[model samples]
Structure formats: structure tokens, C-alpha cells
Target: MADIEDEDEFDDLLELLMTNWRNVRQRKMPTSSGADNTAMVASTASTRKNGGAKDDRQLAEDAKVEFDMSSGDSENLPDEDEMEKKVPIPGGVDIDLNEQAAPTIRLNPKAKKVGAPRKSKTVTQAGDKSDRKWYQQAEQGRQQAGEVTLRALADALAREMPSLVDTQCRLSGVIVKFSSAESKKPKLRMLKNPVVTMDPFYLLPPKLLDACMKVLSVANTSECAIEVDGSQETRTVAKKDQVETVVIKDVGNYSRKQIENFVRIQNLKTVVQLGLELHKWLTIEGIPALPAKYHDVANQVAAQVLETYPYTQIDCLPALPDFTFSMLYRAIPPTWLSDASIRALCVRLTHDFPSCRFAGFQDAVPHKTRTRRSSAAPVSREIQDRVFQQVAEEGVECVLLPLNFHNTHWCCLVVVVSTQRIFYYDPLNQAVHLKAANAIAQHLKISGLQAYDVAAQNNPIQFDAFSCGIYVCWMFIRHVVRGPPLDMSANALPRRRFELFFYLLSGRLLTREEAEQHEAEAAEEDEKMPAPPAASNADEEEDVPLTQVAK
Candidate 1:
């Protein structure tokens, strides 16, 4: 209450103290604290307010002397704390008076004096100076912003291309499209926007893949196309006067195939070409060839086609083995070895592709601790565990189960992952292994596999009793190759067997080069061979070799 009149005085006192503090800071003077601070500020203000100009001169001289002593010639400043606290504040960045962020300004002990002339008086406010120097004021801000943008760009680029940093895989990359014939490397081709990339065998046209798959897709699923003809090169099956050409129908029914333009086609070569494309597509999509997933419907269509069209042998060469419809290579029927053959085929497929798993035909033997009431043979927990783990790890696309029901006959069950369907294939009899198939399905369901419905396949029929095993093995191969169609008669099996033998001997899938090589050979053969005897207007004019499909 007594200091009510002093309210204005107190406010003035605070203002003067603040002003005094600012002036001391500019000259780097030691700041006095507590009661002494208040007293010194009050006295200075009173002296200036009363003594006017003369007292201000004294204060100014004192500030000049202080600055000269601290920062002029001597390396050491007596008031070290004063130098640490009183840093040169950056000009004109907005600072909150209520919550000022105090900066820690370190004064180097052996500090070299900054190359700036000292001003006699302090200019506190931004507006006091006519020259604001906008560039200087925003220097720190600009640098900070630049760093942030650069960081962001670096992060984005890394995500898009981690290889950008590698010298081998520099971001400034080039692509070279060269032929197998080309010996010398061409000049580097700069990658343009929307980069065009292709496989190593890019020489083969992409359009051919669809055409080839279309023919193969049907041929593989159908067993009728799996045929052999050693003298197929010499034989002419059909003379179509309507098309004015001789069309060899090949071993199986290629009734629907349009082979009206080529020199010749070897059926095995076509199968090889088809197999090659299947592998390429599967590899591209990361789908397994044998016992795979996702590419089911397309595979099915291709497989079904195999049943309808026999693999036509058009481009048969003299050097290649005679693998036609002969008794020497006739399809052998399965006997006691049927079970072993089927199991062996599954094993072979599994070994070929890591994605495939073969569940064998052999039943688990009962354990010594088995109860009399338990009529079913006991399964080895260790074996079951291992199988489950393997299937899980391999992506569970397809499982081939070759069953010998009641030690009587052979049957195949293909478990497709994506479709969740078990293809129950028994060309001789579908009812042969119903109980066994059911039991297998139940076991799979119980053993943590996805539930699968048994779907009947129009299996290829066998002539001899032993052919069931052969059929089962062939089916296993088909599964690995995304399936070939079922053959109607057991006659085609011999041809199919011969093809399989060639594949095994070669130990590699046929490529575009192989097909192209055969084409060259066919062309040579056509050039050497004489023109066919021309018939009447109703008869054919020229030969139309199987050129309907390509890979």
C-alpha cells in the first residue's frame, strides 16, 4: 500500500534495468546479481535522469573501456562468465519475451577476435538500423532448410533404388539388346523413361509365348498327344485339298491344330518348346513347375488340351532317334514295380524342384506300443512332423500323393494349394482308391494342411494292366511341368515315354535356340526334298507342316 505511488516507479525501474542489462551485454560487462543488481540499476537510472547528458557520457566511456579491455588485445578476459552469458544474439528472429530459449554460447579461451568494428552504442531493436541485411539475417534458416530437403531426397531415392550407390549398378544405367550371334558389344544404350527390360532369351518373340502356351496347355493335359513317330519325317498323314496342302496329323488327334504353313514339326520338339515356355513363365512369376500354385487354371487348360491334340512330329531329323509308334518303344504296363515306380517318380520331381513334395504310396508300419483296438497302422510322429514342416516351408503349392490301394492297383492324387483341391486321377478306375483318398485327405486336414476336396480328372486310359504305373509316373511328370493332357489310348504312352527319355538324356529344358536350330534344319530338309506330286484341283498343292504353335 505504501509503494502504490511507486508502482509507476517500479515499472520504470524494471524498464531501466532491462535497458542497462542490454547495454552491458553489448560491451561484455559482468552482470551483477541480487540486491546489488537492483541497487546498481536504480542508481544508474537516477543519475542519468537527474544529471542528464553529462552522466550519459560517463556511462558511454565506461562501456567503451570495458569492451576494449575484454576483447581488444589480451587473450584472457577477467570476467569469463560475462563473456559466456553475453553472446552476440542473431538479429531479427522472432523471440518470445515470456519464454526465451537461452542459447549456450561457448567463448573459446584462445578466441581470435571476430573481424567486426565495435560500435560505441548498442542498437537493440531491428527497426533502429536502416540496413536490415535480409540475406545475412536468413543465412542460418536457409542452410537448415537446404539440409532438410537434401535428407528427404536421399531417403526417397534409396527406397526407389538401393543399387544407386553401387558402382556396378549405378543409377545412370544402360541396357544393351544384343543377339546371340553378335560377338562385339555395341555402344551402351541409355535407359529411357519407362525402362524396357527383358530376359536373356529375349530373341524369342513375346507373342510366341501365348500361342505356344495355348497349344501346349491343351496338349499336356491330354494324354493322346504324348506320341512318337520315327519315320514321322517321311510320313504324310493328310492331304487337305481345301487348303491345297499335305497335313500330317501326327501320332494323336491334332484335329483342331492349324499346321498349314511350316516345313515340318517333330512332336517331341513341340513338347520341348512347350515345356520351355512353361518353365520361363513359371520362373518369371516365381511359380514352381512341379507341384506349384496360383497358375492353376491356365495349367489346367494347357493340360486338358494335351488330351485332345497329339504332340505332332513335324520337324523330325535323321540325327534324332526314331521314337515313333513302334512295338520296340510300346508303352509298358505296370506290374509289381508299379508302387515303386510311382513313388520313385514323386521323389525325382521333389528333388528336381524344391517347391514339389512327394507323399509316397507306402503305408506306415504299426508301432510296438499300438493298441489292439487301433486297427489303423500307427504313423511315425517324427516323420509326420518333418513332412508338415517341409510342406509349410515350400509354400505348400502342390503335393503329389501316389497311392497303391490295398496293394492292388496304383492311383495318383495331386493336391493343389491355391485351388485347395485334390486331383483324384485314376484313368483305369476312379473308384479304385476312394477309401485311401478319403483317409489321405482326412490325415492332411488333421496334420494342419488346408482342407482339400477330391476332384476327378478325366485320366488317360491304359491298355495293359501294368500301364497304370506308367500312367501314374507320367502324370507326376505332367504335374511338374504344370500337367499334360490325358492320353485316350495306351498307344500314345510309348511315344510319351520316348519323349521323357529324351528329356532325361538332355537334362535341360529346350530353349528358343533349340527350336530355332530345328527350324533351320527343317528349312534345309525342305530345300533338298523334291516337290510333292500335284493332284487335281481337288487335291493339295503344297505341304503344310505343323507351324500352328511356337515358343
Candidate 2:
């Protein structure tokens, strides 16, 4: 009975071991036949450790069936022993092999998002086909109109003031209508109170008109025209009943004296012509006259003529004439003869041709005489020799000899050929000298004269004078012996005075000592005491201090 019980117990033990082994083996085995061969071998070995009899048939079958497990199959299988090691303890504590590997979840589509639209490629048109036809036509038309207007203005100006075309002249006037039985054309008139009517045909010389036309063309192209109206009324005859009737009335015309004065004031060329004629007759009669001096007089007459008509070079001489005659006339030096005799001779000569007498001489000769004494004593010959010696030592070219006429007046006739020019000086009238200098300077194309001292050993031929008057008669004669009408206005006189003052003040014609003295006197006068104070300002208070006020 004991033997039989042992046998049974052994069988039961074998069965229990087999059952545990099978469970472990099933857990270890891969779920698919494609499991890794290494894992299958490990399962078989583990099953043997559980004390189960090795099943050769199962081993052989597993070997025969080749398993090909991928990485995913291997990751899905769990180790039986590792699972057993992680089993929950008796205290109910959970076991983990490692923190569970977090599964990756994609949530991109669930999130809110904002974005710009993608740009599409743009297509360009062929070219600019917009119409510019009207714009181009308008621009061309404007240019054409401007050109036409400019041409017409130029044509009109060419018909008027011809000289004004080429030369600079200030034009001031208005347009008016005048009757010519022949044709109709707008006539330009002077804006004077009497409405001076000018002949359109003879308004300007042909040369002047042509020049004016060219200028007008250029000006018209550059500028616009300004039209003006006259204050005077035009006389018109509308019907036969309103025929132009004239009543014969004794309205005294200009008297002989008035006419003479008018002519003298307005016609410088006429005066010059008359003087020239009279001089010529005087020369032919062999009146023991000074021809050289007369020539000088003729030149002055010509200059006066030029002053009248500055538009044309006709009748004006090309070269300057000598001014010696004008200088002598103005100086009126005392002749060796008696004063009474000289005065008598002057009266007779003037009386013989009163109309031909010079306007200047008419005013000046009456009080002058041959025996008039000079204010400054005559320079002695010895002094002159000493001056010459000194001039020679200083390398001077020439000497200026000043001749005093009346006690108040003096003159100088410089005969220095070193500069190939002559200079005249009248101490009584500085304008005459400056004009003469300017005329000579222009003619000779040489530097103008300066005040020189003829006595100084270092600088000879330089002298100081209270005043000087130079004659430019020769230049006038050379330029225009026969010319157009002259203009007589007081404008030249004032200009001459101004020029003389400017030259003198500039120290161009004065010695250092003379300039200094004149300046000192002027300063002294400027420094004089002020006049009595005027009444206080109306806005000022008596007690208020001027310094306290806001500026």
C-alpha cells in the first residue's frame, strides 16, 4: 500500500509541474509564427527550468517552423519573469516596469490659426495705349501762336523808332489816329499836353528804324506789350454841317526874342552851324584872328551840336579837336593892350552879329577886360627855370604853366607831348576840365589826367587847383560837324556838375595837402554845435526816466 501511494504522488507532482510550465511557456512564446527564433529558444529553455519533461516533438516542430519577427512584434511581447517580478505586493502596492511610455497624439488640426493669403503672379498689359493726341496738339498750337504774335510785334516796331531798335532808349508815349488822304495806319504820338503829332513816315531814320525793329522782335519774343491812353481829345469832323471852320484871329506868334531863346534852348546844332559859318567868314576876311584858337572854338560848337542830337554819328567828327580856344575864351587873359580898347573891340564884334554870338560869351564878356589883373602874381621866369631844372632832375616829361586872368579866375594849357595828349584846366570851372579830360581820354584811348606837381624835385608836373575847366571842343567838331537836330535840356548841365564833383572828391585831381585841408574844413562844419532842443515828445511824462522805458 505504501509503494502504490508513492507512485501516485509522483505522477500528481509531475502533472502540476507540467501545468505551470505550460502557462509560462505560453506567456513567453511569440503570438505569431513570425516571432524571433531567439525568443522561442529562450521560452523552451525557461520551460525546462520549471522541471517539465522536454517535448522533443514540440521542439522539433518549433525549429521546423522558422519565425520572422519584426521590431513591432518584439516590442508588443512582455517577458514572463519581468511580469512576475512586477506583481502587486501583499500591501496592494502597484508595480511598474517603467513609467508607461506616453503615446504620441497629433493635435495640429484642432488648434486655431491665422495667416496671410499667398500672392498670385500678376500679368502685365502690352504697353501704354492711352490717347495723348489732344494734349500734343494743344501744346503745338500754343507754341505756334506765341511765334506769330512775336513776329507781328517785331514788324510793327521796325516801322517806328528805328534808332531805338539797336540803341537803348526809354520809350514813353501813346498811339493815336491821324488822317492822311492816302492810307490808314496807326500813328504813335508823344504824350505832351499839346499832343505833339509826329509824321509816321519821318518818325525815325531808316537805320534807326531797322535797329528798333530787331530789338522789338527780340523784346516781343521775351515780353508782353503794355498799352496806354492819352489825356487829350481827338478832333473829328462827322458831317458837312460840322465842317472844319477856322476863325482868323490875331493871336500873337512867338516874338523875335522868344524865338531866339527857344532856338538857343532847343537847337544846339543850329547854333553850332551858325557859329561855324561866322567863324569861317571871320577866317577868310583875314581879321588877324587866331586860327588855332578858332579851330578850338569850332570844335566846342560841334560838341554842343552833339549834345543836342546823341542818336547819330553823322556830322560828328571821328577824332577830338583841340580845346585851346574854349580855354582862352573862358580865361579871357589880359592882352598887352588897354582894357578900354579890348572892351570896345569886343562890343563891336558882338554887335555886328548879335544873333551869331555864343550864348556863353554873351553872358561873360561884358564884365571882362584886357587889363584885368590876376589874383596870383605872375610866376617869374627865374621860378620857371628853377621849376624846369627840378623837373629835369625828377625825370619829368613836361611842365604845366598856369596863367591867371582876372583876380578870381585861372587857366592852364598843358603842352606835354610825352603822353601824346593835351589837357586844359580852368580854375574857375571844374566841370569844364573834367569833361575835357574825359573827352581826351576817350579819344586817345589813354588814362585820364591827374593833378600833378611840376615844382617838386621828386614828382614834377603835379599841381593843385581850386577848380579846373577843360575844353572838349575838338572832339565834338571831329565827330559831328554836320548832324541831326540837337536836344537842349538842363540834364547835361547837372550831369557835368556831378561828374566834376565826383572826380575831385575821389582825389584823382588833387594834391594830398589840398584834399586834407578840404576834408578838415568839412569835418569842422559837421562838428558844429547842435541847435536848441525841440519840445519834448507828446507821449513822454516829465517824471519818467528815458532809460526805464521799454525799447
Candidate 3:
């Protein structure tokens, strides 16, 4: 009976041990904390005092049992008889049940259950305790794992002292070792977690640590077979064998080569801005006088262009004749308009509406021309010749010329040669330049047309300071089409800017319906896209990790 009782108690302990092992295997080790570091240090010190040989022996025994259980090789596991011989008796007590008188076992008063049924715990209370226990056990297991890994590394390094070859050890999918040779090369290697810091190095003698580093430096870089002990199995890993990672390069929110036209339009503003900046830099030695407040705006614009633009070259888009990037930049809002861009728009307008004749910046002279000291000496014959040269050839009924007043404001002048009427359009709603209107009238008369009369007409009022050129460009279209009153509201500015830019690029104006439709599509796509970080140079490639690159 005594022998049977002892065997039963041992079986219960064995059952508890097996149950603990299963729980440990199912859960992952927790991250190390301050308490974990203290626990790890204490464990490492205790391990070192006990010597490496003892730990190795214990590890070997544990590994043998664990391997047998994992591989379902029960035959290799110790039998009950062998286990009974090896394991000590529980509580260090021996019983004599055969003597017919059982010895009285003294129980500690402090440990006795003297309360009323130990007060049954509620379900929530029990669950809370279970969760706390789980966390505590996980923390303890992590410290133990870290301690064991450091011990293993030290022992391996010591054993291979003066001739350290490639060594690797993994615990629960954690890589705890890396070769010095592998680390020196420019290869993307796996990073070790719960890293053993230089604190452990101080534990070793100075001479020994120095010798270890020297040995590692002189270590051979040749490929060698190494054993890696994982949670489930121990396998041989070679240096030459590598797991490949694939990275897919994409542009904007969409995939490569599938970028939408609206997405490209969204980035065109920045491309034009940068190209203008580059051109300015080429001409001037220093930056332009645009306020420093726009510095961040320019930087952010460049970043968006780099991160989301799908093409490598800007030349992919249709080019405008006599329209440089600087001129394109001026077509956008808040930037001063350029005469070249206005001329380009006029050319396109003439192509679409052949009944009208348009004048270049030079054709209708905004500045006073040189005149001889005689009445019949052609007061502005040179200007008259240039302005009507095209109109006479085309036999057009109407002529429009965009005039720049003192190089600060943009206004338009229209002449109905057949009706003998002239209309002046000013973006600011201010009175038109009388001198400019009279100059065009004289040119028309010199070209053998009837003298024109000035007609009073109200034009759109300019709200912003720098958008006069945009308003002037729009006024020409409205007057030609005789469309509804122009929308010069704040909300319409951005829409007009985008439309004007699109027109300049495509050589055809987008109707109101088409522009609004594209804007809606762009808005939807914008909401779907995740915000990308500011990338200074999109051409610069990033070194993505193997795990993410694979995904």
C-alpha cells in the first residue's frame, strides 16, 4: 500500500507536469519588461554559478523527452520503472502503511483551511485570477527562455573559441545568433529580438571577451552546415540556402501602369510647379521672391508628385506649342499669368472658332509705338499692319486682343469691325485703358475698316489679386460663346484652374459636364486612397524587409 501510494502521488505530479508543458506550448512568450530583465539577470547568474555542464546535461534530458513526445516515439521515452528510479519521492517522506498504525502527519497551522468553505469565488473573479495567472506564467517563461538562449550562445561561442564558425540557435521562432561575417556584408539579415545586450559582456573577463571578438573577426566566410534548434524540431541549415522575397513596385493609389487619368491630373500641378522652379534656377542664381510662407507648400507638393505620379518622365503628356513649363505654371491660380500662355490659348481658340481673329501680345501693341513728326506719317501704321495682317487674310468679322496694363493687370479688347463697335473687358471691373482702345480703333481704320465706336459693357469683377489673367482668359470665351454670366466665385477658381490646365495640355476645352464628372471621380478616388508620407525623391528606392516584401 505504501509503494502504491507513492506511485500514485508521482503519477499526479507527472500529469501536472505534462499539463503545464501543453499550456506553455500553446501560448507565445511575452515581451520582456523591467521585471523580466531583473529575472533574466538573476537566472543567468544562477546558471553560470551552476556551470555550463550541468545546464547542458539538464537540457539534453529535457530535449530527449520533448523530442520523443513530439515525434510520437514513445518507445524512446523512459519507462515507468526507470522514471521511478530517477525521480525523487514527493515531499521527501516515506510511509509505513503495512504496520497497521498510520503515523500522524502534522499540518502547518498557517496553511490549514480554517475558514467556512473558503468562500466560493464568482465566475468573474475566477476569470480575472485565471487571466492574471496566464500573464504571470507567460512572463516567467519569457525570462527563462531568454536566460537559456544567452547561456547557449555563451557556451557555443566558448566551445568554438579561437575558431568560431557560423553558429545559429532559434527558440520559439526567435533567431538568437548571427555570424559576424554575415553581419558585415550589405545583406538584409533577420533582426534578433529580446537582444542580449553588452551587459552580458561585462560578466565575462576582459581578456576572454577580447579573444572572442578577435576570433569572430578572423572567422571564415565560407559556407558551412549549421544546426538550428526550433520549437518543434532541430534541422540543419546551410548558409547558401536562402528564402526569396518579391516586391511589387506601384505608382499612386492604383497598381503599376493602371493609373487613372484623373490621378495623373491631380499630380500635374506639382510637376508644372517643379519644372517652373527648375527653369527659374537655371536663369537666376538664387530663389525667387515668392513668400517663404509657401515653402512648406512647395515641399509638400513635390512630395505628393514623387510618391503618387505613375510616370518617370513628364514628356509623356501632350506638349503645347510655344508653351514652356514656366508658362504652364502661370496658368494655375495664385501665380502671375504669362503672355506666352495667353497666346497659346488664343491660338487654340482660333482653331476651334474660325470666324474670329486673335491678336498676339505684339500684334496689338500695348505700349505706345514710335511715330514720325508728320500727321500722314502713319501714326501707328506698323501696329496696324501686324494686327490686320491675319484678319484680312482670314476675312474674320471679330478681333480680340488680351492687353497687359503696365505689366500688372490683364484686360481684353474686342472689335466688331463690321458693326463698327468696340467693347473693353476689364477683370477688375475698372474702366478700360482709353489709350489701348483708341490704339486698336486707329489700327482698324488704318487697315481700311470703318472707325469703331466704344460700347459700354459690364465685365466680371475680380475677387483675388493674382487671378486677373485667369479671369481675362475666361472673359474672352464667355464673350465669344455669349454664355451665361461668368462664375468668378471662390469655389469656381480651383475648377477653372484645373480646366484651363487640361485645355492647355489637351488642346481642347473640357465642357462643364465633363469637368464636373472627372472632379467627382477624382474625389471618390481621393477618399479611397491611404495618405502617403512625404517622399523627397521618388526615384530613391527603399530597402524593404524580407517579410513585407514577400507580402
Candidate 4:
């Protein structure tokens, strides 16, 4: 009995082990395919949320497997109640019971929350960044396209009309419709369709248009027109004519009249004063008088007294006033006269005129002779000295001596008369001293005395004597009269001389330096003085009294 019991226990133990093995295997296998059905339901829910159709649901149902289980026809026995108990649910649906549980699939706890996406957010952050970059690139491309369109329009205008190369045409008044069907491109319309339309082709040159555009860009506005009247060419021609005819009619005529009027006016008193002044110089400076033979004529002519007497007696013959004849005796070559005449005149006059001496020639000295005769008249040095000494002894401040010549049928004889010493010549004495020809020749530094054609010859001796006499006269006038020197030249006087003359004429003598200083002082005084009150007309009534004017 014990052996049988032990065997039965072993059998029982084997049965329990088999039951446990069956249970374990069942748990490892799929259950009733219901889990797949649950998976279909979950898939259907996902599809419905994603806007899928019922056809997809039907397809899911068609893919499902159907199985039936009867309680009476069962081949296997059911499990105990404790073994059939359900397990705790997980976060995700179970696909394989044998497989390890997925780490709490989580079901995206934050899904469909406030900021979460309603759909599956399977795209990566890098993909989203890429998408944004692409969108920005597209926007940039659109902007670039707009710029390219404008640039193309501008380029088309530039190519069609070269005159509009750098210039922009703005639509004034109204915008015009440019039909692409009509002309394949855009065009500028400065005016409406009318009888006359300016063709851009013939309007302006390409180079000029470029220049115009540059000017317009600087000015920032179109305020000027493209002058097509050929005015530029006309202006150029007009300018050429203006340059050629520079002198105006009135200006030319006035200049000529001014020159003529200047030459016509002469001062006679200045000439007489000049001669008297020369006589005074000769007397004060100890220059000798003229030679005895020619003394009377020299004095008479130079004193301007030749017109006083018609016929003057010289050595028992009658002598007439002859300027032409007198000039002949003084002829000398231009060059010889400049050097020799100055020296001879100064030497002779130093004796002839008691006070005057010959100053050097100021104007250009001539060098050409006009006479055939080389010999010239001379004056003696001894005679001139004796004459000067006599005048000095007479206590005469100044003396003019005259020399006269009488050409008779027999011979030519001369007489000397001193105007200053005319009172000294007594009619009772009745005796006249004469200068020898040799002495005269020696004093004059010439070989012989000969006649000269005054009209033909540039007589330097006479010219020198005239200039020296003028200079001496000017010096004497300046020194004795203490006044300005007179100008006898035909040309206009120097500015300084004119100013001096005007000052003397005005009876207000002031040097230029003094005048400037006085002007400055006067200006200062004017500034210091109070301004004068404004004068009112009687017709214009005054609103205030004179005492209340300042207030």
C-alpha cells in the first residue's frame, strides 16, 4: 500500500508539472487575435484623426481574422479563474506577449496640449530650419526678380534711344498705357497722341544726351528743354561777329575828337612868361650876354619884341624881323649839335647871359644834317665875358641883348644893342664896339659862318638853345616866383604837374603827402562829428517838433 501510494503521488506531481508547463506556454503565445483587433481599432482611430475615409476602415476589417469558440465542443480544458485574471495595462498596446515591454511608450503626454502639434511631429528641427531658409531664399529671389524687371526696362529704354542713355523720362500730366501687343516693349510719351510727335531718333546726339543726363542728375529735376532750334550754332556765329567788331561807333568817334581838341588849345602867356623867366635866369646866374654883332637881334627876338619895330637900324642899314633867316645861322648836324652844340652853347651863354647856364638836352638828339654847308656861325668867349661883366657892374638883375643885321647892296653889317644897358648907350658917345669874325668863330667852335636852310635842316644848335632856354626859364620861374613850372610842350602835362597846377589854381597849395595826411585827419573829424538831422519838405507835414526830434 505504501509503494502504491508513493507511485500515485509521483503521478500526481507529474500531472501538476504538465499543467504548469501548459499555462506558461499559453501565456507566451498570442491570445484570441483580439490584441490585433485592438491594434486595428487604434489604427482606425489614428486614420480618422488624420481625415482618412471609411474605405480604409473597411480595408482594416477585411484584413482582420475571424475565429469562433464553443464551450461544449472544446478540445482543451479552460484555465483556473486565478490564472485567467487580467494584468495591469501598459502605456502602449501590446503587439507580442513574448516581446519585452516597450519603455512606457509614453503616448506623447504633452501631445495636443496648448502649444503641441495636432498632427504627428515626425519632422526634425534641422528640417524645419532648412524649410525656413528655403522660404527666405524664395522671398529674396522674388525681390531680386522685381529689381531685374526694373533694370531690364531701363536697359531697354537705353538701347532703343541712345539719347536717353543716362537720363530718365518721367511721366508728366498723366500715366499713359503702353500696350505690349502694339510695340513689343515700353516707350516714353511726353505728350498725348497729336498731329506732331517728336521722334527721339532725330532729337539729340548720343554724346550730348549723355551730357544732358549727367546735368539732370546733378540738378535732380527736369526744368530745362532740349533746345532743338539750332540756337547754339547761331550763338556761336554771333559771338564770332562780336569778337571781330570790338570797337563801338561812339567810342571810336569820341576818341578821335578828344585827340583833336587837345591839340587845338595853346597857352600864349606861358610862352612869354617862359622867355622873361629865361632872361631873369641869365641875369642872376652870371651867364654872359650875346656877342656884340648878334646881340641886338638875339635880344630882340628872344625878348619877343621883334614885332614892336618894323625896321631897326643896324650899321646904317634897315633890318627886318626874320625868323627864317636867323635859324639859318644856327644850323648844325644832329649828332654834332647834341655833343658840340650843348658844350658850345653852355660856354657861350656862360659869358653871354649873366646868370643862366645851358642845361643838357632832355629829348632825343638828332644825328642827321640837312644843310650842304658844314660851317656855322660862332660867338666869341671874350666878348661874352665882357658883356656879362658889364651887365653885372650895371646892377641889373636881368638883361636882354639884341643884335641886328643889315644886308645892303654893298655888304652885310651887324649892330649890337643891350636892352638892359640901352640906358647906358649915350647918343653923344655915338661909337659901337663890334665882335670880330675870327673871335666869333673861335667861341662857336666852327670854321666859318654860312647860311642854312632852316626848313630843310634839323638845326641842333637852335634846338639846343630853345630847350636850354626853356629849362633855364623853368628853373628861374620855380626859384624866383616860388611857384610851379609851366609846361609848354604840346603833349598833355604829367599827372604830378597837373595836380600841382590845379592846387596852385585852387589857391590851396599842398604837397601830395600833405594832402593824404590832411584827408585822413578830415575823415577822422567827419567821423567824430554828429550826423545832421534829416530835412523835411513843407508839403510833407512833420509829426514832431525840432526839439523833440531826437526823442
How many clashes (backbone atoms < 3 Å, residues ≥3 apart in a chain or on different chains) does model 3 have?
0
**Winner by TM-score:** 3
Could you give candidate 3's per-residue lDDT for residues 74-148 as a string of tens digits? 454456577656743232233321123434443222244756764457876897896686456544544543433
RMSD of each: 31.0, 38.7, 34.7, 41.9
lDDT of 4 by residue, 465-489 (tens): 1233222222222322223334434
**Taking the tens digit of each residue's C-alpha lDDT, what string does model 1 give over 1-551?**
34547788888677667756765655434445546655555655555455543533354345556555443644343455655565543433333322323564534444478788665555544434623443333333334323222223233333442221131122112111122323321222222221222111112222322333334324343536656678656666784333111111221111122221110212222433344443344344322323232246335433432322222121221122232111112222222333433443454456666678875554522123333545553334554565566556646677776666556566667777768776766647544355445555556656666565666665566566566666776776666655224453544454454333333322333222245666899999999999889756856566668687776
Per-model TM-score versus the true fold = 0.29, 0.16, 0.34, 0.14
Arrange candidates by lDDT, descending. Answer: 3, 1, 2, 4
Model 3 CA deviation exceeding 4 Å by range: 1-321, 362-380, 393-395, 417-420, 431-435, 442-447, 512-551
Displacement of the residue 538 alpha carbon in candidate 1, Å: 44
Query: Native-vs-model 4 lDDT?
Result: 0.30
Q: Candidate 3: lDDT of 107? A: 29
